[model samples]
Target chain A: MSGLKGWREIPIGGLILDAGNAEQYKTGSWRTYRPVWDEGKCIHCLFCWIYCPDSAIIVEEGKMKGIDLEHCKGCGICAEECPPKEKAIEMVLEGEGKGV
Target chain B: MGKIVALTGNDAAGTAMVQIKPDVVAAFPITPQTELMHKFADAVADGEVDTEFVLVESEHSAMSAAVGAAAAGARVMTATSANGFALMWEIVYIAASNRLPIVMTLVNRALSAPINIHCDHSDSMGGRDAGWIQIHSENSQEVYDNLIQGVKIAENKDVLLPVMVTSDGFILSHTLERMEILDEEDVHRFVGEYKPAHTLLDVDHPVTFGPLDLPDYYFEHKRQQVLAMEEARRVILEVGKEFEKLSGRGYGFLEEYQMEGAERAIVALGSTAGTVKQVVDALRERGERVGLIKLRVFRPFPKEELLEALREVKVVAIFDRSHSFGSFGGPLFTEVRSVLYGSDISVEVLNYIYGLGGRNISLEEIEGVFSDLQGVIERGGVKERINYLGVRE
Candidate 1:
């Protein structure tokens, strides 16, 4: 993560950046959505807490918890790790104009 | 009998593609090129042709589908323009590298940043290194005829390289003109069924396709592609001969008009060559020994033929539609100079950039190019900067 800023210098020749035409990015449009914990349907599985790539999902006490949006790029790893059949954690679109 | 009908270049290409009866047709619609696909769809729906038409979401996907189909030993066709071609840039290389005989119609348009959807050589010129056999058509008739012949050249067992038949967008693609349409059986016999040397879907004798080659093998693979392109030079001429026998219309790598005893010649490609020829004829009527060389096949460039054609000429003016910025020369001009390097011809070559982003290249502007060439010939060398016709601040 510390060296991630250097990736901007990489050339993706086909990419076009037009300042006049700003793109609209809404949350939850990704085909593979990331999940956030609600604590209401926690079964103490702790599955999502272990599998997060960024380790953004935090589990307090004996139950599962929500994501820390500060570091999460919404890759959906935690949602995929969650074993609960009730599927307590869900991925939803952010409010209009809200991205990620 | 030779009959004529008015049709856009896109429509002409689309009509030819449908008549060819390819096994799979996949393409993403970009302006100018969109009309080609639209016309193709209409033909498919009307049962004018029997083919599997896959409507892909993007040019990248379109090329991917084409590769997939070609790998399955299907005769495939596709099309794109400008940024769309840029999007498929990676796969365009892949198609040629894997020896897939995919025939594509490129409606030459300008790549965008300031956002232009008009005509230029920028699109195909950008993909010049992609290893596809490239042909530049000067009119709707050439576009139609080349689409049929390109398939033959590409699908030849000895030369299994993808072929791109290009014509200027809007200028050639949308302009209606009377052109001869070949009989279906004649085209079918001329092109024949594409029999690939290898295919992915052959379950009985399975072989790997597009494996990640190490450095040692990668160089050889590139060498093979080069050999295939060189083979294309012979295949194109052979196919041109067969097509002439069937259609009674002669075709060549480069078409020269009134070059006999001429001191100066103007060389160009695409629709602008038509205008240049008109200008040359007008000048010739006035006793100016001027001629025009229209390049029909650009890739596997007819270097030897060009040298032979210009061997007696004193001056050559090359009109380029796309400029290689910062190089201070056009792509075609650079290649021409390199080809003529150290040759005993001693002919002076001048570069002229014209019709960028669909700027109208009138007969008068072409005459101006010739006049400039004549001035250079008289002066024994070019004194002014490389001419940029129709450019404004």
Candidate 2:
């Protein structure tokens, strides 16, 4: 978040100053849809984490910690990639209840 | 603290590499440029240097490996000419954008269609806008000297951009020249060690290189590279001064011969400057007031210096060895004319694109160029701006 002034403030190359700090970018603002996860149906296949373009899926200690909404761009990739008979992950409008 | 040596341009560049002992060298063979890498390979085999040589299959892989090595905090060197340089086009921009201080010896040659292995500036000129600090050399000595300074200039924190030292292919690359090579210790001291500001191998402080930047930050990052180029102009002179302390040669944005109180002058680059200087001297002896400006650095184009150099001249001729087809003038001419725009300078400037594809540029052609300048001055204006010299009509 610091030193994000004009283009001059960035380091000489495109070196990211805040190492591994993609969260600061707040990419979630770019999302028009949100993904709701049902832990009950999760097989922990981690397919959503593997498919995430922004690495926005949160995985902690051999268990899925749901989605990291801070960095997720609401691309619906996680829900599309979720593998279950009924689909554990579903996409929904920002103000709407979790869609089927 | 120097010794006189008879060496070709390629051998001299190889000598510089042997002296510097860069951490890694990734290069492939191209005519006129191949011998340089051959010499380096011999150096490595002979244990003259411990440089890690990546024997890449093509110039593209050569440059790609160079980018990887440079990003990993290793000082890297490479060499190529013409088509080979063209092959490295992709990683060339990435290397500069990633702020890797990769030093390259770009043997100037024409691109192919008829396919020739000879001298021309088309190769490097095509790469002129690729964000590398370009320094042209007139001979083997300049090639050697420029490489020594290029390392320091590119690695400087304020700059941190790639630098390419070029000499005319075959004309300088193969021809023998008398040179005063500095003591190995002196060259080593002058080049110093390349300490990158941030590198991939710096595991303690991890860094991402060439990250995708959207509209929110892409424009600003490019602006920083622009500022770095401006900063390089200052660092180049500074590093040249430091190199002068070790070796007697002082490098600058451009080299001026005569024009102290001249009416007309010729602007050129690379080894052709030597030939132009000879013509200038001959014309001067015959009471012709002509001078020459040999552009050494073309990337951080010395506009202000060029304006100052030609301030007293009445008529100027800019000769480019490369052609920018469908354009008003060649790359050098286009940039030079742009700088003089909107200025109050009372100088008539003309552009001449010649010697493409290693065409022989004789002294007669040189004299004819001066005669045309005289014609332009007498007429008080020029009808044609871009003219070719020595081409069959």
TM-score of chain A of 1: 0.53
- What is model 1's C-alpha RMSD? 11.0
**Lowest lDDT block of 10, candidate 2 chain B:** B189-198
Tell me each candidate's RMSD, in Å, in order: 11.0, 2.7
Interface RMSD of each: 16.6, 3.0
- Native contacts kept (model 1): 0.00
Alpha-carbon runs more than 4 Å astray in model 1: A1-100
In model 2, where do residues sit more than 4 Å from their true spots? A1-4, A27-36, A43-65, A69-100
Residue-level lDDT of model 1, residues A1-100, one tens digit each, is: 2442232232111111222121222332433444556667767687777877666676678655566665565777666766758676677544422243
User: DockQ scores for all the models shown?
Assistant: 0.02, 0.52
- Index of the highest-DockQ prediction: 2
Score each candidate by Cα lDDT: 0.82, 0.89
